[model samples]
Target chain A: MASPPRLRAENLRSALAGPFDVSVAAGRCLAVTGASGSGKSLFLRMIADLDPNTGEVWLDGRARSAFTAPAWRRAVAYAAAEPGWWTETVADHFPDLPAARAMAARLGLKEALLDGPVLRLSTGEKQRLALARTLLRASPVLLLDEPTGPLDEDSVGRAEALMRERLAGGAAIVMVTHDPAQAARIGDEHLVMRAGKLEPP
Target chain B: MNPIVLTPRDLAVAAILLLVDAALSVALRLGLTRALGIAAVRMVLQLLFIGYVLQRVFAIASPWLTLGVLLLMTAVAAREVAARPERKLRRYGNEAVGLIAVGFATAIASILALTTALRPAPWYDARYAIPLAGIVLGNVLNAASLALDHLLGGVVREKPAIEAQLCLGATIGQAMAPLRRAAVRRGMLPVINQMSAAGLVTLPGIMTGQILAGLDPIQAVKYQILLMFLLSGGSGLSAVAIVYLAGHRLTDARHRLRLDRLA
Candidate 1:
């Protein structure tokens, strides 16, 4: 098993990185629920090393700062709430066709969206598509910020189920959400963040 | 040498006016003033400094110095624009080099062949090389800066729609394609606009300078066309190079996000 929460952050903080002071375990999905603007997204960003903070974070017993930026980012994959569309076409978005198509269908999207212009997709469709992209990397630690926050009830359920099915392999999952039901259903552990601090539950 | 005609009172008034403009530029950005005072000051200061530096450089006439200056300018601009403290800056420095080089080389090569080669002047002549190279590099720098800014900002702006793709195993390049397009478009837009408006809308700086130097209007027009074409090519090439180079820099050893550097 990956050793107990080894990533270190002395006073990690940012617009979206953190003021976080906790470590997370591998293979455990830690669900974060908190008030709006309570730094939950920032906390996850801190873990991903995507923002600047005073503290140190360790991955696999190595200091995050010690690793080059690209290495550190690659180790932890973060999926934001709205996700970006870097390309016009779906095939362009997903270089690897089979995986993209399979993940798309798994997330209840029509594989037809792959050939279609991404600009035409609805918000829920985008959310589903973003998840498909994340699944492509298959990172060991998945940091999700409201992965389904923009989706409808049906899409939310579909995404939640997809997350449950896809994330395994001793990978750590840190997710931020407002829905308590999602917290209960998706998380193996729960933490409520407010005013830049995480309350262990 | 340029003639000096201003009196002390005029100089003082001019200085005061410049200072006032400086104050207004930053104030405008901050809503503290109504004009771009700081921007005007910054532009004047930067241009004046470059003017003095180039005057000395032209006097000394060293080719290596020319190349060194170009490299230093490219590095500094890259770092300046890449200043997202939370985002990594080092890798982009090298990538910026690649972008600037494409612009620099292409500009030099085109001009050397078209004008200098046709006339066969000394390759190191500052009168020709300095202004021409500056024009090329300046255009490239602008494009590269825009491209990088758009790429990083676009990612932040549209991250969620991207993250789901990450869950499904999308490569970083795959994830970033949409952003790359946005960035390139943003970078190259100015060049496109300039190309579209070449003659009728504005009197281009090069052609105007040539006319002042006693070149005929027809000759000046040719020079302007050559320069505009150089700038357009430089901008386009630099934009493409910066994107590709940055794409390479963005990934880690395992081809994952450069999370640590993002901070």
Candidate 2:
């Protein structure tokens, strides 16, 4: 079988990440679980190369330093608990509307929401839409920080289905969450983020 | 014309603002006190120097000298705007070069062409061109610098979110969409406010100067209206362009937000 696309983090540390060392394989959904202030999200951040860390990382056997930041990120998708919305219209968030719209619709968003003001979007709507935008282009590696959080039963189910589809497309997923039941359902392997450690599932 | 003098109350208010600004600045970083100091002191020094320089220049009436000073001022203002944000702090000289080349040259060319070429009167006129450019560039510079600081600071703060966008097939420019838009909008705000406030509530510096210079009230109002529009438009473009340029500091050739190279 093909070697699973992997990201090896050799001791990543930051104000948020602390000090972490782990290698995450692709086609494998890795869930990082921890309590509040446990650095779960920070671990995902350093692995994703979103924040500054002292540790080195390798993606797909190539050093992260080998690829420019934009190039690396293009191949890796990350979502935060809070995403910045910079424009009045939702369509402004994505370069192409059809892609964003298609994924958004799958997550139960209407086409009218595209042209409507983004300021009007609810919190759950914001999270779902951000996830949709990510799912549309869903990169080879995905680092998600609470992509689905505190949602009702129905929305969580839809999100879980979407996550599976992304996995089917062969993306390495690194996710941070506290919910064990949710983690068990979506993650192929689980990792706990506590005291700056990526404990294997 | 009676020399316009600040009343005792006006002086008191100025003292209060200066004192309050200094107190607040001690607690705050990013040179609010320095700006206040510049506002209070440099405005005086600049005006003093300009009066003498203009007196001599107005007598000599050399188009080249007036032209030189105007270019120098614009270039200097642009450098200040671009230098306010720290990229590498060590590599700031390169940033200054870029800001001067892009921001200064662009603003200078437009103002010169518009004021001199199109509305050609007694060319190399200090009375008109010098003050006009100063107001435009000075206001816009802070806006530009603030925008850069905000965007970069936000990038570091929101790196994961931005990186996430790129990982999901977003280009560097694509990833920075929110930031770029925010930077430009935030930069453009003051100019927009001045445009909104030009005539309704307060007399802007330009109109006041024009009136003090013995221009008729009606003619001064007309000039102020036109000047406000031009000033707004020019500063808005300069501020936004400087912000984009600031973003270019981090992104590589393909346009990803690269913080590694920056200090």
* DockQ (model 1, Cα): 0.17
Off by over 4 Å in 1: A6-11, A15-18, A152-154, A166-168, B1-263
Candidate 1 vs. true structure, TM-score: 0.56
- Per-candidate Cα lDDT values, in order, are 0.69, 0.71
lDDT for each residue of candidate 2 in A70-90, tens digit (9 for 90 to 100)? 667766667877776655678
Clash pairs for candidate 2: A73-B166, A73-B167, A76-B167, A78-B164, B172-B255
Give the residue spans of candidate 2 off by over 4 A: A1-6, A10-21, A54-59, A62-68, A89-117, B1-164, B177-237, B249-263
lDDT of 1 by residue, A86-108 (tens): 55886877768988888888778
For every candidate, what is the interface RMSD in angstroms? 5.9, 3.9
Q: Please, what are the lDDT tens digits per residue for candidate 1 over residues B1-263?
A: 34245476875687787667657757676564434556666876898898899899888878788767766665555554455223444645544545454545455544664465344356656656666666677677777778776766655566655544443445666666777887889989998898888787988887777676677889889877777777777777777777766666665443345433443
DockQ value of candidate 2: 0.24
Clashes of 2: 5
TM-score of chain A of each: 0.88, 0.91
